[model samples]
Target chain A: MTGGLVYLLYVLFAVGGIALYLAMPRTQGAHAKAGLVIGGGAVAGLLALCAQVYMAPHGSNIFYYIFAGVALLAAGRVVTHPNPTYSAVYFALVVLSVAVLLVMQRAEFLAVALVIIYAGAILVTYAFVIMLAQQSGGGSSADQRAREPMLAIIASFVVMGTIAGRVSDLRELPNSPVEVQATADVMDVPLADTPVKDAGNTLSVGRTMFNQYVVVVQLAGLLLLVAMVGAIAVSRKRIPADEHGPPPPPPGEIGRTVPPF
Target chain B: MLLAFTQLGFSSILALVILGIILGMVAYSIYFERKIAGWVQDRYGPNRVGLPTLVGDLLPEKYGKFHFWGLGQPIADGLKFFLKEDIIPSHVDKPLFLIAPCVSLIVALIGFVVIPWGGQVAIFGQVFNVQVANPDIGLLYILGVGSMGVYGVVLGGWASNNKYSVYGAVRATAQMLSYEIPMGVAIMCVVLTCGQVRLEEIMASQVAGWNVWNLFYHPVAFIILWITMFAETNRTPFDLAECEQELVGGFHTEYSAMKFAMFFLAEYAHMITGCAFLAVLFCGGWDPIPFVRIPLFRPEDTGIIAMLAKMAVLFGKVAFFMFMYMWVRWTVPRFRFDQLMRVAWKGLIPASLGVLAVAIAGLYLGLHRTLWFTLPGNVAVVLVSLWVMSRAKDPVSGREANLPPLTRSPELGVQA
Candidate 1:
């Protein structure tokens, strides 16, 4: 009976948060809009807290809870923020929070890699794109109004609900753990020979990748090369003179384009 | 909770002390730079600005008149920055503009965490490593944190709402991204030779004999890394981001007062960190000169005095490199944008790659960590790569074919 009550409360917060997000006023004052988003974010955060409490009673580290809460809030801001640049910046916060979680899990190499690749490279590129595209301030109508917000929220929430239910169900299975452990062992056979002890964290990861998963690593490199070539081909611009003979300029225009210092 | 409090308190105190030292170093670095520039240009720099009247009055009359060769200039400059009004331009993005300098300062300051300053010291009754944190992935941490420093420049430029600032930001991002590849490759060579990623271990590995420094074996990699350091720090000859004549103040065009001061401080902080990294990787770090063999200053020595001596050795190397940075800044002309990109993509990248291949082959043939084997191999790689590069047609020149050729005569052209 108590489990049913908690489940109902979880659904209530999730649905209410999504409803508030979808109902944000497009034409309202900026302050009012910001207040609405903040209220909605609080509701979503509460929902995450409930899920965390339900999922792992043993995992009660305060730092973990704080990081998880911040990650969820930043992810929420990434999607719902009106300004595109702010959204990209918020996405960086999400990346940082995820990195902290990775650090908590003792995956130091993966955490640093996440920061370097995603926060360092990808997000910088995203900021550049945002700056290049948005010359004016972010007061565009597209930014102001969310297209099909209700549909997006409902569909995403439904998927989240399904995942949450499946996770809870898996926690109740007794024999499922043994079966999962067996599968994990089978998967670990290739990496079993790699020496991890006495090696630094990064060295171990490098050995595992090179020794056990060399083929997959090579494939990933090949995929990156192909993508780079494709990008160059698609973006290359040809000179107009190559297609058509150079047109003669007017008689007096020979030095018109040159600027005088 | 008590355990957490104790850990946090200790770390926080250590962090604050380090921060104070770095800030002081940055302040004096600006003074040193100016003095060096003045010496180069045949003029006195900041000789007039010493302590104020109040402080001078407390000193002896003779000392008061001396002015200490302008030692008080940084303090005065700091005061000026604080007293001036911070103007957030009406047209700029307020939040991003405010956050940019903080990001720059934070990222630059944090890159020093993995740098083994004094190795280990005996304090009170216990021994402790001098570094703030010695993570297993120390090298990668430095690279990762250093890379994030570009975001501060980019955000500052974009938020300024100016054409020149945006252009500067774009150039900075491109230059940083391009140079990082060669830098990473050069660092990989160091890592492979040392068989370790920890900075202190790398330092220890190089202390075997005189001329055993990584510099002796990997001269080409050292040269590449040195050039990339100048570029990464945005020093003169590579400071496209803040090219005064072209981009006005560059990314900090609209920044003023203390906010602008943060960016300036961050630049010097980055130079210090970069030089420290070079010292650790190439020079023997805190190890005494190999041939000199001063017993008190040896790498194996421990205790307070030895730690201080080692730190002094490292600092002297860093200061020498810093002077070299200033010397090059005054000597070399800035590279054009196309020339800068070509140097990285066409020149350094291929050279570093060749060095890597040679290093790998040396390791494979059971000559691992032998300077004698790798030194000649690296020299050969450098020469061969340069020869190959010379044979290739210049891409920049090839692009000029699309433009119309210049002509001086019409009807009576000499060539026609």
Candidate 2:
């Protein structure tokens, strides 16, 4: 009964947040928009609190709450921010917050990898593109305006509900023999023999990736190669004239009467 | 609550000390850079500024004339920056413009946290390691934070609402993206050989042993790393981002006063961090010298005096690298934008990749235990790659045909 009440409250808060987002004015008064965003954030935070209270008996520690809050806040800002450049910057913050969470989970390799790959390379490139292509007058008209806001809000809420339902359903299922055996196999690996003392986690991760999922790794590498080639081909500029076109007259002769020769 | 207070107090004290030392080093590094530049140009650098007026008045006339070889220049410069007018252009993105320099300086400062400076020292019956944080992924943390430095440059350029600044930011983004690949690969060679990502462990592995320093075994990787460091730090010949001839002041064009000073400080701080990283990775952090076994200078030598000496050694190496940076800045001509990209993508990337391949092959052939096989293998890889590179068509040269010829010849002055 408590879980049902919590779920109902979560739905109500989510809907109210979406309504506030949609009701925000398009122009002239940024304060109203900011107020709406704050309202949405408060509702989202309450929903998260409700979900956490309902799902976990132990309740997450302070660090988990802090990182999760930062991640969610930044992620929200990334989508709602009007300026594309600020959006990209907020995306980096999201990546950083997520990296902190991953570190908390003892997945240091993944955390560092996310920072290096997403925040470092990918988001930097995104910022470059946004800055380079930014239109005059702060931004393009489309940037200041949201399209089909009502539809977008509803669709996003539906997706969120579906994911929440799926997660709750998975939580109720009993552990099967195959799942237990798979976990046991993972636990059986001897991580102590790695050369580096403090790098056993990374070593074990690498071992599992290469030994148990070698084929998947190879496929990923192959996919990256294909993507690289495709990107080059797609972006390569075509020469204005045919390669075998008639040779132009000599430079000095081009503008002179002797060009006929 | 008491326990938390103690932990927090200890950390806060340590952080304050480290911050103070780093700031002092950064200030002196600017002075050091100017001195090197002056020597390179055959001129006497700032040698006039000294004590404040009050202190000068208190001293005897002769003593006041000393000036201590202009040691007070950086302090004076800092004061000047503070006294200057802080300008915020009306057209600028106000918030981002204000935050950019702070971001740059903060990111630069954070990269030093994982650097094990003095190794270990005994004090009052307790052993203490002189590092802010000794995470297992120390090297990765440095790389991660180091990469974020580009963001500050990009944002500063974008927020300035100037074309030149945007161009500068674009060039920085491109340069960083290109150089990072080879840099990562070079670091991989070190990590593969040491089998450790921890900076302290890497340092420990190199002390008083055959293949003592990573520089000997990974000579090619070291060269690649050195070149990438120049690119990474935006030093010549790769400082296309802020090239005075093209981009004016680059990303910080519109910045003034303390904000501009922050960008300047950030650059020096980054150089210090990069030099320290190189010292730690290849030169053996806190090790007196490669393959030289001083009686009291082993990794296990945890005496306070020994730790001090180790710190001095690391500092000396970092200073040498910093000096090398300034020397190269005045020595090498800046690369053209296209040429810079070619050097990174065509030259350094393939060279580093070849070295990585050779290292992996050596490891596979059971050469991981010693530098005996790996050193030769690396040398062979470098030579082979160089030969292959020379045989390939020069991409930069071929592209020059598309450029317009000079309209007015120097001898002719101007066409009639």
Candidate 3:
């Protein structure tokens, strides 16, 4: 990547940061309209820059463009939306479009699993919490205003810039035809034309997971189990008297049952 | 007997045809729900709404007056819905409110595409499948789409800006999340037993050479799936979200006109899709008999007549399942909210997990398809679950362990 292109990328991120800071919901001074327009422009500029740099190496499909655009747009809405419920809903849209993008890359099982877990389960829980919270206390000042917007935006943009720099560096790797074809096979080919290719994809994923990554999978499951146990322990109710260290039950009364209501 | 259309064209045409059939079925299912309610309560339903006046005039008076068992009532009901005033309440979130019903209807409609209505049809010497699309992850696709149904109800409830509506949405979210676990586990049982994730392959496994339907081998899983299906569709026994006595029409309380009708249509559409999916999974889809595969209706039989016969058989199974839905709705009373949660978390989830375990064991034993291994395994799981439930120590109605200890009220002379 050229020094000029890197500078241009930084400029775009700076513009996006400004737009996002301006767009963050507030109780007064509605600059949302201006912020949204500026943010959209910044995003489009970023996309164009990326397309110019990478479209030659990665032969573009129209669906790749459409779904990726929608994912980015919805992700922006997820952050900028005033209402928490709407934010969660926009997040679901992001999940869906990203899932479609995954499917285009022939990760059908992973794509559907993403929809089921993230869009279906996690986002619904988020929406539920937002709805319950809003009912209890309708739109607090905390929800209405962004906290330390400039610092947060700068921090995130710095991380994104670093990743972008690294990605650009990847383009200079030994561009062997075999590696190029492998990359194209893994990333560029849409599975819709030959769905038969997908039949083996799931099987291969399962085989690889259980064969090579079996320990990793089991450890992940164990981590989840530990988290669940911790959650249950934290959420369990304790009587006020118990905080003062109540005496143990008498020997004869040990394991005594509580009467049903 | 076919045209000059390409295979893709024919599939597209079949997709349209299936859509039309499903819409028609949805319209009539509502009528049948009412008719079944009437029958259960010992009264006639929609008998007054015969053919339209224009159509009646073209027929003889006696025949027109016969009412044709209220066959035209759905059409009349549909027309009324169209003519009615569409109301958007002032307090609601307009965008989400508008999108909710559409989401509901689209999610409901899209689930049927993977359901192989008939095995295959030979058209103009070309073999075309009688399905919209048969993705490799067909069953999971259906599950994913079914999970998406939560969005419509949640959005509708939230956007209604009513307390009852919010309550309904919260309940729906919890119920769907809870039931989906057992539902997925039950499906996993089927996938394990058949060693196939594709709906057509699953069906083909059942249809191959005197093989029995999955219902016989995994009866416990079938029962679990049946119960979870009701919860997933928000039908009675599990319709806590919109139970009229408590939530006052629940999520659709604020909906009216075409929007309300869309929600109504989506419910019936969900029923049809769920039933079709259940048939494809547990019953030998498009195979007329379980143990005995008739030569004419075997899945391999790809003639036009065979395809039509297979389609009729599949539709018949779907209709039977739909009827069971209505019958159960009328027969069983709705569970209390806490009881509903208890049933899912304590009862169905464990049972489904056990069923999945049995399926895994059956697979390992190389008797997944055999009646002896699976049937007895199902029976043992059911018996064990029942025994465990009987030995349970907690209160039956609610989560008492989490509640604070009751205090005595001196004035009321009771624990509060």
Best by lDDT: 3
> Model 2 over residues A1-261: C-alpha lDDT tens digits?
246744765565575456446444355544545545665666566546545654443255666667667776666666667778888988998899899878876677788889999999999999888887884475447776567766776777677766765565444432332343345366674434534333344565676687667899999999999999999999997553335355443334222222232
> What is the fnat value (0 to 1) for candidate 2?
0.40
lDDT of 1 by residue, B204-257 (tens): 778766637888778888889999999999998999999998999999999999
Point out the worst 10-residue segment of candidate 3 chain A by lDDT.
A248-257
Q: Can you tell me the DockQ of model 2? A: 0.35
Kindly report the docking quality category of candidate 2.
acceptable
Per-candidate TM-score, first chain only? 0.71, 0.72, 0.77
DockQ of each: 0.38, 0.35, 0.30
Give candidate 2's error at residue B395 in angstroms.
Answer: 4.9
What total of clashing residue pairs does each candidate reach? Answer: 0, 0, 0
* Residue A188 CA displacement from its true place in model 3, Å: 25
Residue A106 lDDT in model 3?
Answer: 64
CAPRI accuracy category, model 1: acceptable
TM-scores, all models, native as reference: 0.86, 0.88, 0.89
Cα lDDT tens digits, model 3, B286-371, are: 88777875789776688989988989999999999999999999999999989999999999999999989999998898988889
Please give the lDDT score for candidate 1. 0.78
